[model samples]
Target: MDMSHIPDLITPAIPVFVITIIAEALWVKRQRAEAGVTLKGHTWKDTLASISMGLGSVAVGVGWKVVAFAGYAGLYHLTPLRMGSGPWAWVLLFFLEDLCYYAFHRVHHESRLFWASHVVHHSSQHYNLSTAVRQTWTPMTGWVFWVPLALLGFSPEMIVTQQAVSLLYQYWIHTEAIHRLPRPVEWLFNTPSHHRAHHASNAVYLDTNYAGILIIWDRLFGTFTPEVERPVYGLTKNLSTYNPVRIAFHEFAAIARDVARPGPLGQRLGYVFRNPAWKPKTAQAPEAPPPVEAAHPSP
Candidate 1:
């Protein structure tokens, strides 16, 4: 993958991101103070951890994108259908890429291996702008999911550009400041409300709302759950530490431990590939030979 030729949409928005986060932080602080409530949404430590993880993700993404580009470019070159770079192509990909994201995001939640990398985003309990920047360090595992676009004839550059656009679109939805948008906009696009449900640890919200830029994918796929009650953010089993290294690799460590346990090949494979909640069945203890000891003592 040629980095020079690839059009990056994320780097240009870094300044905008910093400005928005600061503005939102100040606004949140004021709102809480005015309401006679302590500021609980944003914390210095949480914000730092989020930014740390975001930086880590960016560093890893620079090198990891080579793998993504290779996978995408390989498929595109292999397929005979070459999609044009026309406006229609971009419009078609805008929707198609979002749909691909919906599927990829859904699998990341349902499969333990993918969740190992994804859990970094959900490590923070605070629902604020910084939380959106909290990203995983190991995104290479998901590079293959978007290769279908390449197979369908989209160029690697187009695929990567659309992906960055999608990532940028998702950044603003991390805030609790925007309660809801217009009804039509809410129904069509992935908004703060829909995303709150996605970040929520509540049982009803556990795996719902996997839309990227469009909420229509979730609505169409039956994964759309509205934010009714206040969302309880963070993982079902929240990590106690604020360390970025732990936040990034804790689930991966858990996966390793689970797969290393003594079990059949199939069971071990399931440990890595199955749901995060899945556990290996323990072996029953063997009964002791009680009579043999008694007989020897009597003799």
Candidate 2:
């Protein structure tokens, strides 16, 4: 397998990121001045944090590519899934990747280890196209989640290509500008409405809609929720500061604190990997009620 093409995978992501930022700035200015909607403008700290996350994503991709190449060289072959050669293959790969992503995403929310990285993405209180760029600095550690695809004999190139396409397909779905699409499309693909529900902090909305390009996985797995009611975006405990360092390391620091508590070995380990909301009995605090509608606007 030629490792040279690995750089190309990341190159396309750059333009998409740039274009999305440009569009977001123009839209945000309009949204704040004309519409009644309040825009959560960026601080330099958040911007730097977002850039750091992007760099982390690139690093993860590079590492994954190395693993993929080794897998191909030793056990598999490099066969690119050609676009336009077969529609069925494309459909199959699309749904398969979505299923994989669904499982990966759900576990990220459920498991503290994964959420430590994913939480950075959700630290933003606002939901806009730019929020999509606020990616994770720790997804590389979760690369094991995609090993099933390689075991199933997907060529390294095909796997990477399909994964890239799936991510690219998701970029446009990060906006509040577009509401519900046509019913048929909404039923099949994930749109802004579905993503908004995923990003929502509402009790009923958390850990829902863990799809990528296709939402069928969420529907099949019973994690799908409709966007009939508007969503309240961000985490349960919103981080008030726009400091990138705080945003990136908050969950990690919390995990460390939890792990430092007096407990049995198993319990101590569980505190770090069980779930983001997990609390040891001694350290447990009162559960706060979900934020009321009066406090925040619905997406």
Q: State the lDDT of candidate 1 residue by residue for 95-180, as single tens digits.
A: 99999999899999999999999989998999988999999999976887788899999999999999999999999999988888
**What lDDT does candidate 1 reach at residue 222?**
91
Q: What count of clashes does model 2 give?
A: 0
Q: Count the backbone clashes (under 3 Å) in each candidate.
A: 0, 0
Residue pairs with backbone atoms closer than 3 Å in model 1 (clashes): none
Candidate 1 wrongly placed segments (more than 4 Å): 37-40, 281-299
Shift of residue 293 alpha carbon in model 1, Å: 41
What's model 1's overall lDDT?
0.88
Q: Tens-digit lDDT track for model 2 on 1-299?
A: 45675535555678778777677767777887887676454544555566666666666666666765575434444433233326676676666767888888899899997898889888776676667777775666555666666655565566677877877777778777787899999999899999988988988898899988888888888999988676877899988876666777789898888778777998889977897787667677778998877667769
> Measured by C-alpha RMSD in angstroms, how accurate is candidate 2?
8.7
